[model samples]
Target: SLEVPFPSSREAVIALRSLSPDREPRKGGISKQLTVSGSTLSWSADEARILRVSVNSFLDHLSLVLETMEMFGSPVSQ
Candidate 1:
């Protein structure tokens, strides 16, 4: 399991949505799960290799998200 903290719950939820697949994995015995609680994201995978790949991909995407957030501004509602 991996736990990542975000600045806010909204940011964490955004990260979770961005990282999650549109549909569940088709392969059997290979599962990846992501959940957001408060300002943190928890990730779990059924295999080591899958976990590694997912983490690397998530980090890459997360960096882009953070950079975008920094470039623009927080997605706060009025």
Candidate 2:
């Protein structure tokens, strides 16, 4: 089980939704279970390599999304 905390609940929910689709085990015997509560994301997976790959992919997508959000989500209050 892996638990990750996001800066905000909104972001945590977004990450949960984003990573939820891959919950089913793939043909390679890889499975993931994900859930979110408040500002935390909980994930469980089988197979080390598959877990690593899946996590890397998710992180990549997350990085892109965060970058986009920072760029366009809202104007900074000065």
Candidate 3:
């Protein structure tokens, strides 16, 4: 399994809620059951601790980011 750490977290892929049938993306799980080991991500979430973030868990983070952006304004650079 591959493990990559996101220092800036700028490359995080956020998912859109509304989508057409043909444009709809597949959920992150098929590979989990098929492969012996899945990819792991290490992001600064909990006290900047490097933890085991599965594909599914990482996707959830993306989805949450998309949803929050839809509601709140974008983050400004300081």
Candidate 4:
């Protein structure tokens, strides 16, 4: 099981929505589950590699979103 905490509930929901549909049909006994509550995301998978890949993909998208938000969502104080 993997649990990730987001900076805000809205960001967590965005991450959840962005990652929820990433599951692909597997031929083996591999299975994956994901859930979101408040500002956290929890994931469970049968295989380590599958989980790693899924997490990597999710992080990639999450990074993009966070960067975008930083770019446009608010003015950064310097």
For every candidate in turn, the CA RMSD to the true structure comes to 2.3, 4.8, 13.2, 5.3
Better of 2 and 4 by lDDT: 4
lDDT of 4: 0.73
Number of residue pairs clashing in candidate 2, backbone atoms closer than 3 angstroms, sequence gap of 3 or more or interchain? 0
TM-score of 4: 0.62
Off by more than 4 A, model 4: 28-30, 74-78
Error of 3 at 44 (Å): 15
Better lDDT candidate (2, 3)? 2
Best by TM-score: 1
User: What 10-residue stretch in candidate 2 is worst by lDDT?
Assistant: 69-78
Over the stretch 1-78, how does candidate 3's per-residue lDDT look in tens digits? 333432233322222222112232336522221111123232322322222434455556555655675687544555
Better model by lDDT: candidate 3 vs candidate 4: 4
lDDT-sorted candidate list, best first: 1, 4, 2, 3
**If ranked by TM-score, best first, what sequence of candidates would result?**
1, 4, 2, 3
Local accuracy of candidate 1 as per-residue lDDT tens digits, 13-61: 8878876765256567548778999999988776777778667767777
Residue range 3-73, candidate 4, lDDT tens digits: 88877777777667776675677787548877788878778886777777667876677678667767776
What lDDT does each candidate get? Answer: 0.78, 0.70, 0.36, 0.73
Model 3, which residues run further than 4 Å from truth?
A: 1-53
Per residue, candidate 2 scores C-alpha lDDT tens digits across 22-50 of 55657756467677888888777765665
Provide TM-scores for the models. 0.77, 0.61, 0.30, 0.62
TM-score computed on alpha carbons, candidate 1: 0.77
Residue 74 alpha-carbon offset, candidate 4, angstroms: 6.6
**Model 4, residue 6: C-alpha shift (Å):** 1.2
